[model samples]
Target: MNARLPERQASRALLIGSSRFSHEGLHDLPATVNNVRALADALTDPALGGLDPSGCRVLTDPTTPQQVGDAIDGVVNEALDTLLVYYSGHGMLNQRGELFLAVETTDPDPRRVHYFGVPMGWLRSALADSPARNRILILDCCFSGHATQAMSGTAPAVSGNLDIHGTYTLASAPAHETAVAPVGAQFTAFTGELLRTLRQGVPDGGELLTLGDIYPALTRALLASGMPRPQRLGTGMADHIALARNRAYRPATPSTVKPRTVSEPRGTTITPGVRSTNEQDPKVAAEFHAAMLDGYRRAKKELNYNAGNFIQMVQQVGGLEAARRLLRASSVSSGFTTLWEKGRLDLAVEAVVLQDRFAGLFSDEELDIARDRLAEYGYSPAQTS
Candidate 1:
């Protein structure tokens, strides 16, 4: 499991939005402004961590690298406080293999980066030397994954809950892939999901959203949205460093906890990995659900995995009613959990069909294991005949 959260501390955020650039070839990224504002609002909300607005600094379209550096210098020296640096703009890599954040007056030419770009190496050095107990760097720009490799080290998606007391970096895309910001969307693709994770809260039975909770959710959210996977990098006292309180969530109880199963009339209570008490027979559907949990449990042993959160995410993205429709449509009078496991009849087709129906909820490994197990039993997922 990820280490438990460290003590709460004073939190401050620096949000940089560069929508308008001086270079003629570069187009303005209007979503940058939207991304910053949305995040800033979440940070300052009283129901959240109740962060002081004065501690948050947002810079837009800075004219030079010095301006960005000055902003970084202001926050890096802060001690025993949580410091967040978020950049939403264009990012580029120069010939010298340095990652740079494009300044407002940045020249987009690939060869002449020193003119208007802020070196990521400089940013990394400042963060490494910081005295603050909590440090987070979030980059929502192109070539952001490069910044992580430039840092300490890149980590796989966090499995267990842990406090991120040392330093953590979240990059929107890999070193080569381009990040996305749909033209009409209010915020950039990555930031939109970040804010959603904060607002929706993890179902991990806590008011605080930690690094482990956010990264996987962001990964799944981006995959569902058809965007490149986000990457997390760095290591040091990495545990539950609380980012924000989950305002839209409350701990599940015997009363409010919904059954994550198909029941007679389909009662409104659900949790992952277990069934709820509801009468009525949808045994086939329930068997399918059981198979899903079986596959998932096998895939996530080390992680303090919460199947419910993944289900909750699917409900949020596709709507609860839509999910109910799926359960009902897929339900049958007779069921076969044992046969399904043994790859009997069309169980492979059945599993694949179910996967296609709710493809968003699974991670790559979980899906692969499920397929592999069925294949071992002579079940071909694609061959219905």
Candidate 2:
């Protein structure tokens, strides 16, 4: 099922790419250009959406705060039908827990983020005020997940303090994590999968690349590759919603195989560049688990306690099953980071691979829960806060 987008309607996208920074300490991102080209090309391809060049705004290496605002305003003004905001740059989380997008002139110091970074709240507010109902934000930067949280409508907004809805914030990483641009890949890991999806189309022969159709494949690719997982909220579309058409797709016979379930456990892989730091050290592993247990006990907050992916794994896949899944991934731990970093593929997998042992850390009881509060964190609050 797909969300019914306005047929034969015009679509507009604001593509912002910040590859270089004025500060010497900040790393330059050469792959952002590749992301912009790939996204614009995919959106513009005749076989896909065929959006006219006039409708899309492409901004590169914008430095001023007003420049970012103006570009977003342009998209909001054009949001009569479909609109997408794609930003590839630095994403910072300040001491106040607010998120800012780093511009070309952004200061390297975290304390000075307010002066140099573009307020993420501005985009949220712009999208909320826009007449358009279908809005999508593809944030490919560090702490980009912060966009999932609704920005406080105040002058300097913090996420999750407000209640804004209807925008799909597809973030490249969880809070506090950095999105990686692989050494050999032409694009960032997050955008590379998106490009591949556009090129290959869904396993199903549907020409339209709906969010639902692409999500599983994306998760599989990123999780298998051990990169920061991209997250999405089913905003504006209760079902699959068309973003672009699959250029390479054609009609085909219906298959017997079913699509992967969202609740199903995903395979884990050791991510590239993850150091072996303390991975094999028993004392370090013990200390990490101890801290986790202590924190959960102290908080007495189920939200915080179960917020751990490991616990979520247990809940979704059952204690034994989750452990088995983790164990399978651990044998090939070269791709995963150390356990101290909250990596799933840990050396301790062997010891906790049983339900009885794992349950000691987390309960086996079923949860009939509400996603309302969690839904508020549409941006990716789990990453930083």
Best by lDDT: 1
Q: Over the stretch 1-385, how does candidate 2's per-residue lDDT look in tens digits?
A: 2334333355678999888898886888989888897888877776666567777778888878789898888778766766788998778877776778878898857688888889777877777777765667788998876676543233245424433344566788876689888876689999989888877776533556666556655766887899987765544232245666665565644593233212211222223223223335455445445543443343334223233445555556644455345433301121111221233322233323211222222221110001111122121112110
List residue ranges in candidate 2 displaced over 4 A: 4-9, 151-166, 236-239, 247-385
Q: lDDT tens string, model 1, 1-385?
A: 2333333345667889999997896788998998888898887776776467877778888888899999988877753467788899998877765578887888877788867788776667666677767788899999898877767533232122333347888899988888898898898899999998888886532466667557766776688779998877545433356677766457658896543322212223433433333213355345445555454454345333333433443445433232333233211101222243223424322353334433323333334444544443355655221
TM-score result, candidate 2:
0.63
Q: TM per model? A: 0.63, 0.63
The C-alpha lDDT values of all candidates are 0.63, 0.59
Clash totals, every prediction = 15, 11
Q: Report residue 198 deviation for candidate 1 (angstroms).
A: 1.4
Model 1: what TM-score?
0.63
Q: Tell me the alpha-carbon RMSD of every candidate.
A: 12.6, 13.8
